[model samples]
Target: MTGTTRYLPPGRLSRAINRVVAALTRRGLSLWGSRILSVAGRTTGIMRSTPVNVLAFDDEQYLVAARGNTQWVRNLRAVGRGKLAVGRREQWFTAVEVLDDTRLPVLRAYLRRWSWEVGAFFDGVTADASDDELRAAADKHPVFRIVPTSTPEDRG
Candidate 1:
C-alpha cells in the first residue's frame, strides 16, 4: 500500500471509543469481531495496544487501518508482526502490507462488513460504492494481510 503519511489521525472522540472497545475485547468480549492488537513500538519497544476490527475475507485474515496511517500502522510496519488478543486468547501473526492495486476488494469487503463504524473515514464511500470509487479511496486506507505465526521467533 502507498504510504499513508497524509491520512488523517483519529480525533479525541474516536480515540475514546476505541479505548472502550479495546478494553472489552481484551477481557474476551469481542464486539463484532473486534480484537486488541499489540505491537512493539518502533522507538520505545514497549508493547502498544489498540482496538482493531479484524476482517476475514476469503480464507485469510486482515487488519485495516480505517483511521489512516495511525501509530499502530507505523508500528506494524516497523515490527512486521503483532498479536491479536481477545480476552485471554492471543494469536501471534506476521503482517504483509497489501499492495495499492490489490486493496480495492479488501477495502470493499471491509466497508461492507463495518461501514456503520468506519464509513465516515472513507469520505462517503459505502459498501455499495462502485469499484472505481473504492479504488480512488484505496490509498487513504492501509491494509495488511495477517499470516499466523506459530511462535514469537517464527515472525523472522
Candidate 2:
C-alpha cells in the first residue's frame, strides 16, 4: 500500500461490532454496553448523537471515532464538550480532541489491549481512512475525548 493510501478503511466493522456488543450487553450477557450519546454542534447548535463504544480506562472515559470524520465528531468539536447516557447512567463531560500524533500511540496501545474486539481495525479488514484523511478528519470532525468534570457515581 502506498504511504498515502490506508491499510484499512474507517472503523466500519468496529461500529458493527459495537452494535452487536451493545445488543448482547443489553440482553444481560455483559454488565455494560455502548450507547448513543448526544451533543450540540458548536456552529449550528443543532443536536446530534451517535452510538459509541466506551471504556473506563485509567479513570477517564474514552470513546473511539469509528466512522472517522463522522458528523458527531464535528458536533463534539463545535461544542468543545458533550454528555453521555449509557444504560441508565447519565452524565456530562468536557471534550478534549486528540490529535493524530497523540492518538496513534494511544490507539495502538488500545488496539493491543482490545485486539480481539478491535481486530477488524488491526487486521486491515476494517475500512479506514488514510492518515492524511484522518488528519483532515481530525481537523474537520475531530475525536473528542470525554472527561467528566464531576465524579460519575458507579451505577454498576
Best by TM-score: 1
Candidate 1 wrong stretches, greater than 4 Å: none
Number of clashing pairs, model 2? Answer: 5
Residue 29 CA error for candidate 2 (Å)?
Answer: 9.0
Give candidate 2's error at residue 137 in angstroms. 12
Clashing residue pair totals per candidate (backbone < 3 A): 1, 5
* Residue-wise C-alpha lDDT for candidate 2, range 1-156, written one tens digit per residue: 002222234467656865776665444454243665678866777767655666555556666654345566656756666666655566678877766555543454444555465555443422244555434433322344677756544211
lDDT, each prediction: 0.88, 0.54
Superposition TM-score, candidate 2 onto the true structure: 0.57
Q: Cα deviation of 97 in candidate 1 (Å)?
A: 0.6
What is candidate 1's CA lDDT for residue 57? 94
C-alpha root-mean-square deviation, candidate 2: 7.5
lDDT of candidate 1 over 33-127, digit per residue (tens): 89999999999999999889999998999999987888898999899999999999989999999976677888989998999999888899988
